[model samples]
Target: MNKRLVVLLGMSLVSSAAFAQSSVTLYGIIDDGLTWTSNQGGKSAVQMQGSISQGNRWGLKGAEDLGGGTSAIFRLENGFNVNTGTLSQGGRLFGRLAYVGLSNDHYGTFTLGRQGEAVGDYIGALSANGTLPGGILFPHPGDLDNNGIDFRLNNAVKYVSPTIAGLTGVAMYSFGGVPGDFNKNSAKSFALQYVGGSLQLVGAYTSIDHPATAVPEGVWTPNNTVNGNYGLAASSYKVLALAAAYTIGSARFTADWTHTQFGGLDPTLGAKINGHVTFNIAELVASYMVTPTLQLGAAYSYTQGNVSATGKSPHYNEVDASVDYLLSRATDVYASATYMRAGGGAVADLAPVLSPSSSQNQLALRLGIRKRF
Candidate 1:
């Protein structure tokens, strides 16, 4: 009888252990906003913008406790347009993220699958563009810098080190998945960040080799010659960024600088097109909270691109401001506006209606609500 009792108790323990090893959760966010653009396609229009405050997404995340201070985790997230109920990120089911990895509190985590690049992860923290209307006006021209506007990569491997003395490091690589051209469309990036007290600092670099070829033929082509260098045969592009922020009480201030270059284009293409373009960006942002539910923020950015081809230089100055009201932990409303002016050769390439001379100006406004669950 005693033997039977021992066997039954052991079976019960095993069942409980199995149950504790696994768990799954569902999470999502829905955001929509009304936007007024001064010259979108040269026609003033009012439209609904999805994923304004945050990308509208639904995701499944799960973990299995593997014992010995380790866990197996995975995340599958999909982006969608709340305005039209269509898939975002070009219709991929898990366009935002799809990764599986092992984690331990002592070591860190290494994940494999689609993931975000270093520039998108590190420098994004210094800007408010990831939140609400900030992204609409503040994203780098064409979102070439990622910051917060661009999202994820495919076929990637990523590693994140445990924080040590307020410092952490991240690295990622994406496979091009092209036949006969192993390096084509591949990319890599790394970043290091330190957060201590009320100060934050970050530095990062990223390179992409032959990205344009990764797309289907006749779908899209790089219009800017500088981008062509990074898209064509045996070519690459690189970006370096440094950003810092300081916080005191309820107010925070941020400043950042970035330099980007494109190189290694086909010589024939380089001759017909600009071989290289060096660009610099500078930004300053400040935010304050009037109450637990109310906050105000403002930012300004300047960008200048030096032409290696010698026709003209492109420069832009933009200013942004917003006010946010938090109704609850998972819900908020905001009003925001931005004004931008382009000069030098910049306006020549803009929409004809908006660019009569080598200069252009624009204003945008948005009002929106968001909720997370």
Candidate 2:
């Protein structure tokens, strides 16, 4: 009887060990709010927006312990509109993040699938505009610099090093997935960051070999001029950014600078359709915690766009402020406002009004609540 009991106990231990090796979790956030925008085509409009302070998302992440300090992991996250109950990120089911990889405590992690670039990962941490408050309105024109743009690259591989002495590094690559011309859609990025005490610093760079083309106005025709065989080498987009932040007590300050360049388009297209453009952006932000549950934040941004082919130089200045009140650990409410003024050549002519042109102004206000579970 004693021998039989020992054998059964050993079997139970083995089964429990196996169960501990693998686990999965489900998590998500829902954010919906009302917003009012003035000068949305010369008229003020009120609309419901999702993910105002944070992008509404649901995700599944899992890990398997392989023993000896090594593990396998994967994540699939999707963005959606809390107001309309629709998929965001260009209608992709897993538009935010989808990847699988392995990790070790002493080593690092390597993942492959749709993922964010290195620059976006590092620079995004430096700005309240990137994290809360301003949202997409504070991004540089076209989000060319990705300082809070949250642009995701499809068919990509990423690597993140374990933190060493308060420092971490990342590298990423994207495959265009285009057949017959593999290099045309390829992109590469690198970033390094350091965090110690109250200080943080980050630097990053990225390059694209062949970027996807954008459709022209009122026309469904393919505008592959940027990547088509007839256009320039198609690999002409580049970006670099530096950012730093310091925290003292309940107050924090941040500063960031970024530069971006785009080139190589089909000459047959109009001036707005082709040629080279450069954008430079700088911003300063500050935030103070009134209490654990209440905080106030503000920011100012300046952006300049220079066009090589069109002789246009436009500039934009913006101011943003917000107050957030935490209702509970899982829920919060906030009100924010942004005012922007644009000046320079033909800025008034750009459609969608998200790009550089002459004489453009906008004002926006949002009040909403968010809950996470």
Candidate 3:
């Protein structure tokens, strides 16, 4: 070969080697199903739904080796409705999750952008709401605790600690980015997790200020006007939760508790807010592996809301069950149902997941299939 050709070939080899350090992947899941509601707007109906078993999504994720045992990473995930081919999460293309950050094997992971809070990440995984079979309707009323992945924060900074002696720690904050006020719509969250043998535990806290001002990101305002019975906005919102799980052979048991407080509020949809609101929710869930390809799950949740503003203390109780048969490692067929009863509460909304029922009781059922790629 000529001298010039030899030099060009040598450069190509070097460039190819450098490119090997960076990798990208395209991934996604599709869940489609049909749902039957015993009561919807005082009318029973059957509807086609997407993401019933799991949210439909597609994304690009990549990692670039930066040396020193640290790497730069990015993820862009989207949510959509497979039934109608429409975008979920208010038309945002990459609404499910989007983030970029650095990862260190010995240190931890830190990322920035729109993402899930610590409660749903560290604690939710141990509950039925985060599982394949029970996720559709497993959340407490209104998904108040986000155990079912109802919301994500915008302009967020998140950090996760490396596991040490069966323990891991997490911290995160989301800046509202308002010009004159840094706390206008800011949010803060923290969590600690422990895993030992067949037992797991998690504790988490999240607080938000002026939740209504950041509506576009799907952050649930105290009143939840986006899709709730009463549109109330709170100046402050906070949630504290604890969860635990234990495994015995093929069966797992989980229990969780959450307390939420809403301070100072304005009504955007319903009666004027005259006082504050507090929510206490408790849940128990169970899952079992009947066989290598079959799994069964069940859950029960009780949520009581003390609406001090109106002295209308309402309570909701729910039960859910599901079964999934794996067609393959990455695919499954599933069915589930949720039944709920309400008393001393006029609001019967299932916001962030489904619409409110016209009556005090509601039953929803679904049959679906899911595939991951």
**What's the TM-score of every candidate structure?**
0.88, 0.88, 0.92
Q: In candidate 2, which residue ranges exceed 4 Å CA deviation? A: 1-9, 213-235, 267-273, 346-359
Q: Whole-model lDDT, candidate 2? A: 0.72
lDDT of 1 by residue, 30-49 (tens): 87888776765356667777
Error of 2 at 74 (Å): 0.7
Off by over 4 Å in 3: 1-14, 215-230, 268-271, 347-351
Task: Indicate the worst ten consecutive residues by lDDT in candidate 2.
Answer: 215-224
Off by over 4 Å in 1: 1-5, 131-133, 179-181, 214-234, 265-272, 348-359
lDDT tens string, model 2, 1-373? Answer: 9999999999999989978889999999887788777756456677787776777899999999988888999999999987678888778899889999999898899899888876677786676556555565555444556655456777888899999999999988887666898776688899999999999999999887655432011111222121111222233678898999999999999998888776664444332346676778898989889999998999887788776666667677778899889999989898988777767632321112232222376677889888998
Cα-based lDDT for every prediction: 0.72, 0.72, 0.80
- State model 1's lDDT: 0.72
Q: Give me the candidate number with maximum lDDT.
A: 3
Clashes of 3: 2
lDDT of 2 at 199: 94
Poorest 10 consecutive residues by lDDT, candidate 1: 348-357
Instruction: Go through the candidates in order and give the C-alpha RMSD of each one to the true structure.
Output: 3.9, 4.5, 2.6
Better of 2 and 3 by TM-score: 3
Clashes of 1: 0
